[model samples]
Target: MVERRRFSRIIYQAPATIRQGGTVVEANIQDLSLHGLLLSTDGNNAELNCDILADIEFTLPSSDIVISLVANLIGIQKNIIHASIDHIDIESIAHIKRLVELNVGNDDLLHRELEHLSDLGEHLSDMGEQL
Candidate 1:
């Protein structure tokens, strides 16, 4: 298989809450990237659906700032949940960017990832307009 990942993932472990409709599940973030995250949940897999969007809330490590975003539950394998961020507030994105920057350690790579994310967002917006 070819590597198709556009963003660098940082190994960040943190407790997170995923809320979809009336169901709320506690999960641990296994890794984080600009566009998505890998989460590990206990036995609450039955409560989540891949077709539904979920609100994920977690605080930055050792900080009081909470990062919240709406994500699409893309896939699940055993206890691991794969989530793709669909919508995030400006503040939350900023926090995530900083976190990635600190962990990635390469300014050029981070810039490239940011540009890719911007381009993807523009492309999606244009697609929406065409519809």
Candidate 2:
């Protein structure tokens, strides 16, 4: 298959909790990117569903700063879950950007990805306005 990812993914493991409605499940982040994350749980969380919105909270490794964001559960395969970020606060986004920047090791590439993300957001906002 062709790769369509616009953001660079970095392998960073961290414990995360996903909360949807009244259900909460613990998962380990397998990898992270600016736009999405891959999580691994012991088993498929039957309570979570694809296309549902959820809140994911996790702290940076060796740091007390908590990064929390709203994401959409887009896919699940056995023990792995895929979530696409839908909304994130300023502080969390800043932390995430710095984490990604450190891992990517290329400031220009990281800036390009940020630009793409910003463009996508603007396009989505325009679509929302039209609708």
Candidate 3:
């Protein structure tokens, strides 16, 4: 498996059934990534480059902030909706990471990056490991 630079701070997922113009469809998100997400919607039946997309809102369990994101359906598997984020930014990534650290505490998950923070000095002092 490839090492992920960012991880999902998933709170929950619900069935996303949307309609635009005159068409109706339903789909689900299997997993979410930092830049994009894995959708399992009825996208396989779509043409090579379909633009049928929608905007969705979801809340983060930590901050309870409902972030609305525009997404595009990319692939499909057995009626599952597979989609990706239309646009993502580094600021959003950092916000999610900070929320995770705040809610989950600064244990293994937070300390995983200690090796990279060695130059920060403070974390080095906390770890009781002298440089």
Using lDDT as the measure, the top candidate is: 1
Q: Candidate 1: which stretches are off by over 4 Å?
A: none
lDDT of 2 by residue, 1-131 (tens): 99999999999899999999988999999998999999999994888977679999998878799999999999988889999999999999998898899899999999999999999999999999999
lDDT of 3 by residue, 4-122 (tens): 65444343344444444455555555555433455456553343234666554445555655555666766555555556665434455455456556665655855555333334436
> Candidate 2: lDDT over CA atoms?
0.93
- lDDT by candidate, in order shown: 0.95, 0.93, 0.51
Model 1, span 11-129: residue lDDT tens: 99999999999999999999999999999988677879899899999998788999999999999888999999999999999999999999999999999999999999999999999
Q: Candidate 3 overall Cα lDDT vs. reference?
A: 0.51
> What is every candidate's alpha-carbon RMSD to the true fold?
0.8, 1.0, 10.7
Show pairs that collide, candidate 3: 39-81, 39-82, 39-83, 40-80, 40-81, 40-82, 41-80, 41-81, 41-82
| Candidate with the larger lDDT of 2 and 3 | 2
Number of backbone collisions per candidate: 0, 0, 9
Candidate 2: regions farther than 4 A off: none
Error of 2 at 83 (Å): 0.5
Q: What is the Cα-based lDDT of residue 71 in candidate 1?
A: 99
